[model samples]
Target: MNTFQLSCFLAVAEYLNFAQAAKQLHVTHPAVSQQIQSLEKELNVKLFQRTTRSVKLTDEGKVFLWDAKQIVAISDRAKKRFGGVAGGNIETLSIGCYNFPCMFLLADTLETLRTIRPELHPRLQEIPFQHIYRMLEEGDLDAVVGFKESANVKINALYKEVAKVPMVCICSGSHSLAGQKELRLCDIKEERFVLFVPPKGMLSIAQTQGQLMGERPPSEFYFCESAEAITVLVKAGYGISVLPDFLVPDTPLISRIPLKDVDQVSFGIYYKSLQGNPALKAFIQCAKENLTALDI
Candidate 1:
């Protein structure tokens, strides 16, 4: 009928003595007897055969004992599992990021969280740039890392700039510009270009580069959705593109030239302003610490 009644039934069944069961449960003998009677009444079955000399289980009591034990065990486990929520002992921090930052920053942040709050579970979800703000506001994500300026200031979230990732020019190994150590916008203005379109309303690497170049657009614009795709096109000698330094994979077939005039993209962490989750705070702290080491 209830955990307390079931517990009393189990104690009596285990010892087969009302006085001993009461002693084991730290309750009075009459209290134990009352609970057993209540349970029998609730189930409409007698659980024990009692005599002046001794107490013994009914045939029904033996079968019901197993179910009672199982119910008690399950109740105990449920309490242990959910009891920590009020105490801040159990937490799962869901972090969102675009592909490149997910690859570069998520690992170090997870390691730090493991060391500091081993009880906290951390999840990393690769999200498109446009959906990040919506996810954070909707309680789907606890925190996110991406281009700092890309996050909408209109959203109710806190933003902390963690790193500045410089944009670099990538060209095929065979391209003439590949020989250059550094380049400016003027040098690549005439070269066919691959442009990355930011998801949603966020600014892409190409758009940022164009802002730095003033009224000049690329000689030819080839649009792609992701950094990886742009890299593939660049490697095939289709066009040159600008990308964050960390997004450039280590490959000899592609050459990365530093851009002198373009400002570095600011990467930051964003979390819902009102949800002061401890795990999110720890993750933000860990991210700031690992930014320099991650070289972003």
Candidate 2:
């Protein structure tokens, strides 16, 4: 019945968890639950089947999901159009990327963007890495924030390097390989490895193996969903992992040693083209100027 209700419905539909939806929307869990309840009541239909352990969409919910997305998209587009006219020519740049700690780095850049180009408003979405680049190509997203080595990037898209993030080997501070100035790929091969879920993660590992000339792969491997998750496992002594240096926490509990032979990933923005897009150009400049302050 309302944009707020529709937004809640879309978030819950995407994540299937009220808590996660609330987190994404920056609202309380009960607030999201209330919105869904109000929405379902207004529609005279049950949208989701709830359980203590899991949340699943009902049959009606499944049918309404696509419609809800379209409704929200249209509403957003209209707001941008009319809002721009009312504000005497404003621009909206829709950006998609994986979730934060990366966004943490972008916060300063976005603030700088505001100062430099107040007319340009950025709309950010935490899309899955698998679909992000494709959305950019499809024009659903104006830009993508990710690594250059990401398997999802295409040749046609232009890239602006924000930071060169080195690949580092991470382990518990008490681990045998800790206290080293740096490490070779072979040094960690015998240890159990923790990686992000593939195929992007696998491509990174393969690239590292090839470039670092690591002959033997780790005997055991663990796959995690996020770098934070991987770091948690590594700190618990579950396994060692290779990750962008910026992703590794500064805590003393973990040792982050640079990989001796691996190349740093070019982390930055990707867009189709900058032609006639002053907003995109200004954003790139702000990102380059501010993101370099990252202690790579």
Which structure among the candidates has the greatest TM-score?
1
Worst 10 residues of 2 by lDDT: 209-218
> Which pairs clash inside model 1?
none
What digit string (tens of lDDT, one per residue) describes model 2 on residues 107-172?
888898998788887998988867877888888887888777544444458888888888899999
Using alpha carbons, what is the TM-score of model 1? 0.66
lDDT of model 1 at residue 109?
A: 67
What lDDT score goes with residue 109 in model 2?
Answer: 88
Q: Tell me the number of clashing residue pairs for each predicted model.
A: 0, 0
Q: Write the per-residue lDDT of candidate 1 for residues 118-193, one digit (tens) a residue.
A: 8897777888766777998999988877766544347677788777888799999999998998988878877777
